[model samples]
Target: MRLLLATAAAAALFAAPALAQDPGHDMPMPAQPQPTSDMAGMSGMRSMMSAALGDYAINREASGTSWQPDASPHAGLHLMQGPWMVMVHATIDGVYDWQQGPRGGDKAFVSGMLMAMAKREVGDRGTVQLRAMLSPEPFMGKSGFPELLQTGETANGVTPLVDRQHPHDLFMELSGAYAYRLARQDSLFVYAGLPGEPAFGPPAFMHRLSIMDSPEAPITHHWLDSTHISMGVVTAGYIHRNWKLEVSRFRGREPDQHRFDIEAPKLDSTAARISWNPSANWALQASWADQKSPEQLEPDENIRRWSASAIYTVPFGHGGYWSTTAAWGRRTSAHGDLDGYALESAVRPNLDWTIFARAERVASDELALPPGAHGPAVTVGKVSVGAVRDFSLTPHWSFGVGGLYAINFVPGALRASYGRSEPQGAMGFVRFKLD
Candidate 1:
C-alpha cells in the first residue's frame, strides 16, 4: 500500500511539472530561449540554476543547506519558466544484499528518493526558494535492509535496531528559504522546515558526489548525518564570498518506527556550522550540536556531537569527474563517547562508467549487545568497492547496474557472536534516475 501511494505520488510529481531536460548527460532536448540576465528573470527558461548571492552556478548547493565543492557535477532535470527556476532530482535502486555471518541476513529491497526545488528572484537583491523531498523507503520495511554492524533507530517501537539500517521517513524535507544580498559578495538568509536538516554533518551520504552512486548506508550514519531528517528546523546564516556561517534550532528526536506520518515538532536541539570553499574544487565544513535525547529508545540521554568534513571534485572530460570526501565525527554523552571516520571516492571515467569505493571505521556499543543490554563501545571497520555502467534511455533518464563487495572487521571479544573476526557482504543493484 505504501509503495502504491509512493508510485502515485511520483507519477503526479513527474507528469505535472514543467518540461524537463537532461542537464548533465548532454542528452538532446528541444531548444528553448536562454536566460539573458545573471539572475532568474523574465528572459525565459534554461536548464540551470544560480546562486542566491553572487551570480554563480547553483551546483554548489547539496543536500539541505550544505555545500559541496563548486566544481562537482550535477545529474538532474532542470528548467526555468518565467521567473521561477525549477530542478528535479531522483534516484531509485533495486538491491539484492547478502551478509555472510551468524548475525547476517539477506534481503531484496527497493530504496528511492525524489526531490524538487523552485526558486525565483524576490526583488533586485532578494531570492526566495522552496523545496520538497520524498522517499519510498517505507516500502523497504520498517526494519530496512541488512547492513552488517550498522545500528540506529528502531524497527518496532520497543526494540532497538541493531545491524540494520532503518527505513527513512516518507517525507524527508519540506522547506523554504529567503536570501537577501547584503553586498556584492555577501548575503543573509533564513530557512525554516517542518521536516528538514539542521546545520550538522557533511551533506548526507546519498547527496555526496563521492558516495552517491553506492546503494548502502554508512556505518557512521548516526555519528555524522543522521540528523538530515529532523522533524523541525529553522536556520539563519551569513554568507560572504566563499565562506558561510549558520546556526539552527531543531527537533532532536529520531523518527519512530512509523514511517508514514509526521510527528509533533520540537525545537529543543541547537547547532552551529561553518563552511568554506577555498576554491572551485574544495569544500570544507565543521559543526557542533547539542541534542536533547536524539534517540527514541534513550529519551533521557543528551548528546553533544562534533563533525568535520572535506570534499574535493575535479571535472575532466565532458560529463566526467573525480570526487573524494574525508570526514570525522564524534558524539559524547554520560554513557560514553564514540567516534567514526570515513573516506570515500568516485571517478566517472566518462558518461557511461563510474567507479566508487568507501572505507569507514565506527565505534559502536550496539553491536556487542542485545536489545536493552549495555556494553562498552567496540570499534569496527568496513571497506567496499563498486562500479556502475549507465545507459541513457531518453533525454532525461538513465538506467544502470552495479555491484559492491564489502569486508567487515569484528573484534575478538565479539567474534563468538558473529562467527568470524571478519565477515563479508555483497550487493547487486539496478538503478533508474533522472539525469
Candidate 2:
C-alpha cells in the first residue's frame, strides 16, 4: 500500500511542471514530434496521442504485453505534458445481480476500476512506460458477488471461494516497461512490476473489446487469464513487425483473501508466449506456463497451463466497430487435465448503443466440492447476452445503463447439486466512464 502511494506521488511530481504551465486547460497538447510519415499525415489530435514502442500507436498495447487489433477504438482521456504522454481510463458500475437455483445467490453491489498510464520517448530509439491500475472492488467486501460456476481464489484466509467472484485488490497493477528500437520494425523490451501481469494469457477480460461493457466476470477466467494479477513479474520480449515473442518469471500463487494490502512478492513460475497481429483487424496468440501453486488452498498442486486465442475487429458505421474473440485453454495437473473454451462478441452499431454476448464451457472440479476438497472435474457451460445504452454527460465522461441474462448448463451428475440442469442468472447495472 505504501509503495503504491509513493509511486503515484512521484508521477504527480514529475508532471507538476507541465500541468502548471497551462493551468486553465486540462486537454492534450502536441508536446512531441511525430515519428513516422503515417502519423505525420494524421490530424493534429491523432498525432499527439502517444507513440508506443517501435513507433506503434499506443492503442495497440493492451493489458500487460498483450496486443489487440490496431483498428480497435480506445475510450480514454489523453493528454501530453512536457515530454510525457498520459492516458486515463476508468469505469464504475452499480449492479444488482441474481443467480437462480439451489446454489445461486443475489447481491447488490458496486465495482469499478481506474487506470492511469504515462509514457515518454528516450533519445528517439527508446520508449518508457509507467502504469498504475486500481480497483474499488475491495469496497465490495471480501466475499464479493455471487456468480454460478465461478471458481478460484479464497474469500476468507482459509477456505476457497466457489460459485462466487472474488474482489480485486485496491492496487491491481503497478508496472513499468522499457523498449529499445533496434530497427524500423523491430524492438527489444523488458518489463517488471511488483504486482503485474505475466505474458501467459489473452488480454484480461476487462480489457478485451469483446466483453468490455459487460458487468460479469467470465467463468473461464481461471483457465484463461487468472494470472493477470500476479504479485511479482519480470518479462523480456522481442518484437518484429507484426509478431512478438516474450517470456516471463512471476509469482504463481493467487492473491490471498485480503484485498486492501500488498503481499510478498516471489518469482517461482515461468511462462512463454507468441503473439501476432496479422493486420489491422486480427490479433492471435499462443501461450504456455508452468504455474507453481495457483490456488491458495491447494498449495501442493502444480499445474501446466496452455492457451490460444484469436481476436477480430472491423469498422462499420461511423465511430462503430464489431469485435469477436475465440479462445481455448487447458490446465494439466496430477489430478487430471481440464479444458475451457469461450466465444465472445461485442458490437457498437453507433455511439449510443452497445451490444455484447459470450458463451463459455469449462471442466470445473471445484464447483461440487467443499472448500478444501478436490474431486473429478465436471463440465459446466454458460451463455450470456446483453446490451447497454449510453448518454454523454460531458466531453470527457459518459453514463450508461445495461442489463444481461445468462443460462448455465451443468452435467447430469451435478444437476442434483445445482438443483437443476440449467440455472439462470442476470444483472442490471448503471455505469460511468471517463471517455
Candidate 3:
C-alpha cells in the first residue's frame, strides 16, 4: 500500500507542473482578411477562407462559408496561432456484453480520452498537424465474466479488471504537421506524431473508433486496453488534380507491455498510401504498413513483427458511400497470424436521416505451447453491426445515438484464458458541437 501511494504521489508531482500552465493562453495577433481564388463554388470559398484564416484558425475560419458544415463547438479552445492551431478534446464511451456465465452476469466496458492537437499551415501552400492523447486502457466491470477463471483462479489474474478501477495505462503523445503548395493545383504535406496502428480491415471490427489502437488478444480477447506514444512522419502529395499519395514512418514502443523492459530497437513502423478523387462526389484510397516490435525484449531476438492490408472506398448516387478493407499479418518468430476484412455503406436520402451498416471478420494463428502443455493453437473471429442517427437539436448543437452487436469465437484453452466467447453487446453515445 505504501508503494502504491508513493507511486501515485510521484505521478501527481510530475503532472502538477503541466497543469499549472494555462491551457487557454494564446499570442495576440492582428485580424486579417480571407483569401481569394479563381476556382468557383465550394472550392473557391475554401481557398478564400484558408488564406483569411491563415494557418492557426483554418478549421474555424472555414466554418464561415455558407456551404461548409458548421464547426464543432464541443472541440474546445484553440491554444496557438499562425500556421498552427492547438486544441483539446474529451470523450467517453460505454460498452456492455450480454454473454456471461451460466449465472448470466453481464459485463461493462468504459473508457475515456483526453487529447491535444496542433495543426500547422505551411504558409499559403498546405497544412500540417500533430496530436497527443491520454486515456485509460479498456476495462471491464467486476461482475463481468467469471467462467474464464479456473476453479482456483480469480479476476485478479486479469490486470485490466484491477487497473481499470484505479489508473494503469497512463499515456500521452505529441505530433502534427501541414502541406505546401507545389503547383497550381498540387500540394505536399508531412506529419509526425503519436497515432493509431493500421491493422485489421472492416470484418474484424477490432478497432471500433480508436484509429491508432491494436485489436488483438489482450486488447480484443482479454479485454485489456493499451496505448503507446509513437513518433511518425507522413508525406502526402496531390497530383493530376485528382490523386493524392502518402507515405510515413512511425518510431516508438509497442502498446500493452511493461515500459522499462521494452526494447526500443524493435520499434519501427512504415506506411504508404494513395487516394484519387475522380469527381467532387467520388473518391478512393489504399494504404499499407510494416510494423516491428514496439517493445524490444531481447534487443537481438524475440521481437514481434507483422505486415499487411488493403482498402477501397466508392460512392454511389447522392450521399451514398461504400468502403471495404482487408489485411493479413504474421508475428515474426511467434505462432501468430492476423487476417481480417470489413465492409460498410452509408446513405443520406435526405437532410434529416442517414443509414449505415458494417460487417467484419478476424482470425489468428496458434501460438506454440511450452514444454508439457496440452493445447491447440489459438484462433479468434468476431463480427459487429450498428447504426447512428444525427439529429440537429439546434443550429449550434447536434445529437447522435448508435447501437452495435458483436460476437466472439475462440478455441477451448484460448477461450478459457481470455474469455474468448463473448455474446452480443451494445453501446450508445451523445455528441455536441460549438461554432
The superposed Cα distance between candidate 2 and the true structure at residue 153, in angstroms, equals 0.6
**Which candidate would rank higher by TM-score, 1 or 2?**
1
Cα lDDT, all candidates: 0.83, 0.83, 0.35
Candidates in descending TM-score order: 1, 2, 3
Q: Tens digit of lDDT per residue, candidate 2, span 1-435?
A: 344344444433343222111121222222333334554434333334544555565657899889888777765555554556566678999999999987789999988788887776777688888888899899988899999999889888787778899998888898999999899889999998879999997999999999989989999999989888999999999999889999999999989988898789999999999999988789999999999998877789999999999999876765677999999999999889999999999998988999999999999777765643667788999999999999988655689999999999999988887889999999999999875
**Residue 51 displacement (Å), model 2:** 4.1
Superior by lDDT: candidate 1 or candidate 3: 1
- Best-matching candidate per TM-score: 1
User: What digit string (tens of lDDT, one per residue) describes model 1 on residues 1-435?
Assistant: 233234434543563333433354232332333547655333443224466434445778898889998787655555555665566678999999999887889999988798877777886788887887889889888889888888888899888888788999999988888999888788999988879999999999989999899999999999989999999999999998899999999999989999998888899999999999999899999999999998888899989999999999988776788999999999998878899999999998898999999999988877866753558888899999999999988756789999999999989988988889999999999999875
Q: In terms of TM-score, how similar is model 3 to the real structure?
A: 0.54
Q: What tens digits encode model 3's per-residue C-alpha lDDT throughout 263-359?
A: 2322255655555445433334444445454333322323233323333333334323343433343344343444444434444343344454444
User: After superposing candidate 3, which stretches have Cα over 4 Å from the reference?
Assistant: 1-91, 101-173, 194-246, 256-269, 274-290, 295-337, 346-356, 366-379, 411-422, 428-435
Q: Which of candidates 2 and 3 is the stronger one according to lDDT?
A: 2
